[model samples]
Target: MDNTDTPSSARQSLLDATEALIYAGGINATGMDAIVKASGVARKTIYRHFATKDALVAQALRERDARWMRWFSEETCRAEPGPARLLASFDALSSWFATPGFRGCAFINAAGETGDPADPIRIVAREHKASLRAFLLQLAIEAYIADADALAGAWLILIDGAISVALVTGDLQAARRAQAMARCLLPTFFAPTTKELP
Candidate 1:
C-alpha cells in the first residue's frame, strides 16, 4: 500500500483519517499523533497537507459539511419540496446517527471541545451553524412565510433541539417526532396557499 502516489490522494487520505478520528472521539481529543497513526501516514505527510492541527480540523470540518450537504440534497430532494423534504432531512440525520460508528454532529462536538471562540475549530463550527441558518432562511422564503427570518429562526431552533436531544438520549424517535412537529409548524407559519398544503 504505497500511498505516496500523488498529492491529491495523500490529501484525501489525511482527510479520511481525520474524519475517522473526529467521528470516533472528537476534535479536541484527536491529536496529530493519533491522526498519523490512524492514517498510517508519516507525520511529515500530515504536516505537508496541514500546517497545524487547527488547519487540519478546519479542513476536516469543511469536508464533513460537503459530504453531509451532498447526502442531504440527495435524500431530501428525492421527493417534492414540502413536509416530505423537511422530514427527509431529519430522517437522513437520524440515519447518520444510526450508522455503525455513530457520533453526534462533528461541528457541535468540535465547538464543545474548543470552548473558545478564538479557536479555529470554533470558527468552523460557527460557520457551519451560520450556513445552516442561511439555508433554513432560504427555505422559509421559498415557502412564502410572511416573516422568513423569524420562521427560519424558529425552525432552526427546533432542528437544533431535535438533533441535540437525539444525541443526548441516543433516541432516533425524538428526531422523527420533531419532523412531525415541523410539518405542522410549516403550514401554520406560511399564509394558506396550495403549496402549503403539501
Candidate 2:
C-alpha cells in the first residue's frame, strides 16, 4: 500500500477509518457501510484487502497495538531507568488519559466485546496485554526489585485499575494515585538487604 498522506492507499485508508470509527463507537456499532464511507474506499476494495470483517477488525487492532506500544515505550523511557522510569509509566498514562477523545484501551474494549477466548481479535488483545506485562517485568528487574514477577503483576493490576477508573470518572489523577501506591509498595518488595535470623 502507498505510504504517502496524499491519496492514501485503499487498505491504509480502510484501516485508518475502521480504527477511528471503532474507537468512537466500538466494533459492533460500526458497520461496513460506515467504514466505506469514512474511508472513501469502495466496499469491494475493502473486501479485496480483507476477506472478512473480522479480519479487518483484527488487522486494525494489530496496527493500533503496534502504534500504541511504540508511543508508550517512547513516553515511559523518557525518564531515567529504575524507579523513576517505573513512575514515569504512570505519568505517560496520565497524558494519554488526558488526550482528546480518550476511550480507555482499545484492546480491553475489544476483549470485552469478543467473549470467545479463541477469537482472533481476542487473541490479539491478549498478546497486547502480555506485551505490557513483559515491559513492566523488565522495568521491575531493572529496578532490582525482589520478586520482580510479583511486583510486575501487582503493577499491572494497578495500572489497569487506574486506566479503568480514569476512563469511568474522566479523572486523570487516578494515575497519580496508582503511582503513589507503587512508590509505597516498592521498598517493601525491593528491600536492599535482609538480616539473618538466629
For lDDT, the strongest prediction is: 2
Point out where model 1 deviates above 4 Å.
192-196
Taking the tens digit of each residue's C-alpha lDDT, what string does model 1 give over 1-198? Answer: 325578787788888889889878877688888887777778887777789988987898888888876676687667666555655667776676677776767788888887678988888888888877787676666556677788677767877787788788888777778777877777667665545456
Which numbered prediction scores highest in TM-score against the true structure? 2
Q: Once all C-alphas are superposed, what RMSD does model 1 give against the true structure?
A: 2.3
Model 2 C-alpha lDDT per residue in residues 46-65, reported as the tens digit of each score: 77778999899999999999
lDDT of each: 0.75, 0.86
Q: How many backbone clashes does candidate 2 have?
A: 0
TM-score for each of the candidates? 0.88, 0.91
* Model 2, TM vs. native: 0.91
Model 2 global lDDT (CA atoms, 0 to 1): 0.86
lDDT of 1: 0.75
